[model samples]
Target chain A: MSSTLLNQVAFYLLSAIAILGALGVVFLKSPVRAALALVANFFTLGLIYFMLGNQMIGISQIMVYAGAIMVLFLFVIMILKDQTPEEDKSLFQDRRFIFGLLSAIVICGLIWALVINPTMQSFGGEMDRSYGSPQAIGRSFFTTYVWPFEIISILLLVGIVGSIMLAKRKF
Target chain B: MNTFLNLPLAGAVYEDIPLGHFLTLSLAMFALGSIGVLIRKNPVIVFMCIELMLNAVNLSFLAFAAYPNSHVQANNAFESAMAGQAMVIVVMAIAAAEVAVGLGIIMAIFRYRNNVDVDDMNTMRG
Candidate 1:
């Protein structure tokens, strides 16, 4: 078969895996198990990006998210050295569980409706073109979005400082 | 009955799945993550759910970048796709910083309270 057909198959498969992983992350009780599930989800998402032709994003998602962020999570988990605590009874006191269930049902219903009826094809019907390159992203970041780029750097700086302060003992 | 049963297999070759498929997948993932955030009590699990939501948004943006029909139809595909990618870049940066800060807070709270339950933080509710 042609390469495009290959891409479609890959996309469907990866998307399925990613969604399942996300579901696992949500449903799992142990934080460590949930974190592992998140890693799987990230890997599947990276594969999806690869199928979409954004090789750079695919790689970054794996390297940054699965590698760096997850390691950070595991490090914190280890330092805390806490096994799964008793499930917090106070958690079920509120109507949050009911709310969450309702929200999920409503959202799923909306998605099913949209998928079946599909009146508005708002996003993707253009001719196939290569919008998948690092240079393109770089140029745009340096150009119109330059201010926001600088702002994001500042935000990072603040986040780092804040995290350090919070983690440190004042005495 | 024959063609109906064989339809998916038949047109699987020519039928290029569009951005909508990816968007729907992303939405479903995001919803799962949202439920985790709402339902789960563990701090780390909550944070993981947040990350999942971020990934879902990133996926949607990437799909739009890949198929910039809106931009292409308007004769500005290159610039529009770049715009979408730039947004994702910024989002990833912010998400990274948020994770760091969030974990730090969790660490401090754990040190002080010996637990990270969100409901347990209701100290001011006299």
Candidate 2:
């Protein structure tokens, strides 16, 4: 029971950080500052993943989002070197804001009706202690998902080749 | 009065925190991301918002994997978890590939234009 209380505290704290960082990513004008906030958000999410007992995925989240994807974003932002792009002071002036608001409302209603209203089955089952471990995830990847795993490699390769083609200057 | 207090966390098993809290967190993050994508003009920031949205989805997947519903193949809960974890692995790969291809496109645009704004890039608008 005490452990459950600890989990709740940690979860709330991480959630707060994640949400704040997300807000920073959205509202901050400077791309570099926004990217840094996003890094913080990703790290908090990774910690949450660890708290949830997904050790392997927590590691993956850190390595992939904070390390690789963020680097790509920072590199692009540096290349662009734009400090701030838009000058509109009022968010209401942006026509797209209304659409975003509408979509959010629609999504909220749908989720409430579909997911929250339903009597969900409580997660009463014992947590599978060994399932989320790195070795276990790796084993399943190589065994059950081996062929499908190759598809990721193929996708990455295609991304690499296509990016090179698209980015290369016409000489 | 006690029941009212338990209403929000009604069916929680309490071995850990309620899964509903996680789902709510995911929903909030996704909503924020969508708003950011729509309201923000910076292309790079828009990309970050999309990443946030994807991360939110990942959070829900992990939530389910960590605390799978008792009703889902109770005898084989481990298998269901494996499935969720596998899907998350797939999502991560997709996100990585997307970033690679996406940032490359952005760089290409940077090479072409002195300033990049979503409102201005309408060459293919139908």
DockQ of 2: 0.38
The segments of candidate 2 whose C-alpha lies over 4 angstroms from its true place after superposition are: A117-121, B1-14, B73-75
Report DockQ per prediction, comma-separated.
0.37, 0.38
For candidate 2, write residues A70-165 as lDDT tens digits.
988998888788543774678776677788888898997799568854524455576555677888899889998997799999998998898889
| Per-prediction tally of clashes | 0, 0
Candidates in order, TM-scores: namely 0.85, 0.89
| lDDT (tens digit, per residue) of candidate 1 on A12-119 | 787778877997897766677778888999998887776666767778889989999998998887776663355556654658877997888898779757752362
- Alpha-carbon shift of residue A36 in model 2 (angstroms): 1.4
- Supply the global lDDT for candidate 2: 0.81
- What's the true lDDT of residue A61 in model 1? 88
Candidate 1 on B1-126: residue-level lDDT in tens? 455433332213213675668778888888888888898877877888899999888988877776655435645765676677777878888989999999998888888778887757798898
Distance from true position, residue B10, model 2, in Å? 24
Question: Which ranges in model 1 have alpha carbons more than 4 Å from their true place?
Answer: A88-95, A111-128, B1-15, B70-74
